[model samples]
Target: MTVDRDSLTELRDLARAFAAERDWGPFHTPKNLAMALTVEAAELAEHYQWLPTGADHELDERKREGIRHELADVLLYLIQLADQSGVDLRAAALEKMELNRLKYPADQVRGDARKYTEY
Candidate 1:
């Protein structure tokens, strides 16, 4: 909760400039950015695709670097999508966490993985 808001703003500005510099604004639609974000997420997941449970802890430096880049790609696309959609990503995330807390109270859902509506 102590996160600096300006840092996020900077990142958002960076995403905007990145697209603008590449003359990619026309392609940076919310839909396109969303799809790109999903693709980056899938690439990130590919690292763990066939790994056993503890495999996450055992990744080598090279694989870790690749995962880092994939995560950055996902983050950049996400910022761009939010910028295009006029959504405040950090605020939305905080709000969602509050909503989830109400939906899945720790007292009621502790150790449970089912959807809140199911329980």
Candidate 2:
């Protein structure tokens, strides 16, 4: 699904509902959620850990689906943590992008993989 605010809201609601149904709300604090998000991210990374660079493009359908599910899990936890913490994720993301733009101006950084500080 698209990563717009409306879609994120929908996913957030679904996540909240899923947790509510299982009485997991008490354990869904920001810290716990953040940790879970990190774990899920690690799990997602595992799918590509041993692959050579560019090998991700060769993943078959099943591996792709596995990655998709891990991504979804990471997103769900992030949405949940953002919701619980009263964060406006879209705005924060846009603001961060603007900061990155200043740090890595296109004309100077194009085709360069170096850190902004290195340049």
Candidate 3:
């Protein structure tokens, strides 16, 4: 999933509207958004807690839907946090991917699971 800039912008606007409609702007400080994002991420992780390494690929429809909802929650919170913090999520992700490519060069790290520092 590559989400375009327009989609991210739409998500950000939706998140902003949701917060505003609920009079949540005052409570949506960067710290609070970050904490909420972490919580949502944990919730998403919980859905896969006891699954086998490749179990996700075999999820039943109901379980897949549950995972989908959890993923949505995680994404929504992340979008809200990024919007509140004035961070461009798409750009940051791309930049980080570039940095990761440098850190974990394919030829050296191929089929390896060690940290970059270990290489």
Candidate 4:
């Protein structure tokens, strides 16, 4: 699926406007926002701590739904953080991947689980 930049910008604006309306910007400084993202990510991970990674094998539907919601919350916070920081996550990710490719060449690292230097 493709995301439209304008829509994302609009969404971020709406989120910021809502937060400002409630006087929440003071709580949304970079450090606080980063900590909040980490907490939400931990909440997402807590759901699957000892559970199987497959979808169809889960026993409880409610647990699965809760996990999905928590994951979404984590992603929302991440998107907000990126928006606030003026970072293009996709571009950054691709740039990092290029660096990783140079550090971990496929011929040496493919099918190996060792560190880059070991490879």
**lDDT of residue 99 for candidate 3:** 100
- Candidate 4 residue lDDT tens string, 31-96: 777888999988877877787674657648877797889887776677678866888766777899
Each prediction's Cα RMSD? 3.3, 3.6, 3.8, 3.7
Q: Which parts of model 2 have CA positions greater than 4 angstroms off?
A: 1-5, 54-56
Query: Which whole-number lDDT from 0 to 100 does residue 19 have in model 3?
Result: 83
Residue-level lDDT tens digits of model 3 in 1-119? 97656788899998899889999999988898888878888877777777786285867787788879888988988888888788999999999999999999999999999999986
The whole-model C-alpha lDDT of candidate 3 against the native structure comes to 0.86
- Cα lDDT for residue 74, candidate 1: 93
> What lDDT score belongs to each candidate, Candidate 1 first?
0.88, 0.90, 0.86, 0.78
> What TM-score does structure 4 among the candidates reach?
0.75
At residue 102, what lDDT does model 4 achieve? 95
Which one wins by lDDT: 1 or 3?
1
Q: Write the per-residue lDDT of candidate 1 for residues 34-89, one digit (tens) a residue.
A: 99999999999988777675275778888889899998999889888888999998
Task: Name the best candidate (by lDDT).
Answer: 2
Ranking by TM-score: 1, 2, 3, 4
Assess every candidate by TM-score: 0.90, 0.90, 0.88, 0.75
**Could you tell which candidate, 1 or 2, scores higher by lDDT?**
2
